[model samples]
Target: MSRAPGQFTVVAPGRVNLIGEHTDYNDGFVLPQAIERGLRIAVCRRPGSRALLASDRGGPPLDIDLGAPLLAGRTDWGRYVAGVVAGFQRLGWTIPGFEARITADLPSGGGLSSSAALEVGIATVVETLAGQALDPVAKALLCQHAEHEFAGVPCGIMDQFAVTLARRDHALFIDCRSREVAHVPLGTEVAVLVIDSGVKHALGDGGYAARRRDCETAARLLGRKALRDVSSIEWPSLEHRLREQEGRRARHVITENDRVLAFKAAAEAGDWPAAGRLMRASHASLRDDFEVSCRELDLICDAVGRLDGVFGCRMTGGGFGGCAVALVDGPRASSIEALARTACAAALGHAPEVFLTTGVPGARVE
Candidate 1:
């Protein structure tokens, strides 16, 4: 597709959860920040009921009809665009069908929320084209809805919220139940390192949903709205009544929420060591209790643990496989990354992809 004059470009960022994992759905707290890497969608209005979309990732240009029925099957990237368009329509905004060319620096399937970046970026484009401004919070919710209704992923609000509302130089402390945000500054000289284990996971593919179901079961058994309302002290009283897996799932959510709060306080106080300790503990709970971490993710985190100048490491996304985020000494970032690479390669027989990045501003039209 050729670039059109007057095309508006919007960039939306991917996020790395620093200390919270799988807690969003439980209505617990999460600490995440937008990364510099993200996706860009360039859009411009067209004359008819159809829109065209092309991507730098290489695929046939997608032709979509604004007034037509949803496609019968998943069309890869097309599903994301169609989902956003449908999202707007559901809001009673009849946006013009347009042409879009997507460009991205985010690593797809690395658990950095590349999908949320695409969804939020395109949602911004559609909202802009309609001459309507959406509140960031509402926009984030709509994007989450799009993923659930259109993309078939029962994702929580963390990814979309971070992509749309994160501020530069700070991590977002989100109360998933209240949808309240607090920007916590990292005052220490720590840098973020993301190591992609070359292992990919599609959360909608099943495991994620199963884990969610387990949580739901625990909540029902405990007579709570969600596990978020259940205290760690109250969990043991209900644990025996649940299946072993359900009990473990409940334990992870309750305990992880505690860690998120601890990490937030540590981050704000420039206490990197305490924050790191919580991060490592969070990963261990996810691995042993939640049963989400895969071998590759474990190897990457283990590699980081042995490296000096690294505060902590853990699998940062929905698990199964993705990236491990490490908080490292800013001045020794290079050496820590090199050590992590060598260790991961030795264990996995191939070097993992590593990115050294910083917190960046959230979505905006450029």
Candidate 2:
């Protein structure tokens, strides 16, 4: 195959939530890490008025005018790229028309941040082409805005932040309200595995949005600006003020944020057992109080929760259906996978895709 000269390659890694589910949108805390799997964006200047975008995953090419208005109602993957281009323009960067090809090893709905990888990868490519540099903070916030305004998912900063600023072999501990990030290393002899439940979820649907609304209502009723301001200590009294579901949502956010902080402390002290216990507790809260879990997710967690070498297992994404992560002994990783597959097939009528993963570096130019 003939290749164009000066074609730039950009890589943005996907992320898995180690803990802290559904806490991001509430301006709470999240522990996420960039994974080995990610998106690859290759680009070269076209020297014309339009930009051509195509993907190796089989979709029609998107031809966009360099000067056209950036619209928000797009319902396809191209919307992600268009959103980044629009973001660059909004940030006053000069981006020439270009031909770009996208490819990925990341699964779209496996609870990994595939969309953020695409958006950030394109933003990096655009910045390189424009001969300018955007700092990590600016890059993350910009891509987050792109998702909100263009992709129509009111996602939090955790995905973009982890994709842009993650460190190798470390999980990012971020306070969404403060935007402060800390990189905590994984201890030796520990392994992280993700088991894809073969279920996909769309966050734009009412389920995700409805949960966010409940949190907002909880905040308003408490006279606080956000659920982040409410302490877990106050949950007992606060639960009586709101309706059952709203109170449960508030309880999850406050308690989950606490779990993240405790987990971070435990991880820093090389206390894998404590960290694993926190993860199990977080999943229970998400399932019971938050009500974001589905049967498939429960099956994975229940099956893996009792394995001898397994430390903890819990559903890892925005919920309803997606992947679950398990922390286990490095040598026992394969055993856990086999156990999960057998148990899931017997209980859920299907087997899951289980694989091992580790924390890797964030997005960058290749």
Best prediction by lDDT = 1
TM-score of 1: 0.95
lDDT of 1 at 158: 97
Q: Each candidate's TM vs. the true structure?
A: 0.95, 0.95
Model 1: per-residue lDDT, tens digit, 1-366?
545565778989999999878899989999999999998887888898788889998878998888775532564777877887777776788778788888988778889999899888988887788888789998899889878877788999999999999988889999999999999886449989999988888997999999999999989988899999988777777789888889999999999999999999888888898999999999999999999999988888887877888888999989888888999998888887788888889988898888888888889988
Tens digits of per-residue lDDT, candidate 2, 68-114, equal 76878888888888888888787777678888888898877878888
For candidate 1, what is the lDDT?
A: 0.87
| Model 2, C-alpha of 184: deviation from truth (Å) | 0.5
Cα lDDT of candidate 2 equals: 0.86
Candidate 1: which pairs clash?
none
Q: Cα deviation in Å at residue 129, candidate 2?
A: 1.1
Global lDDT of each candidate: 0.87, 0.86
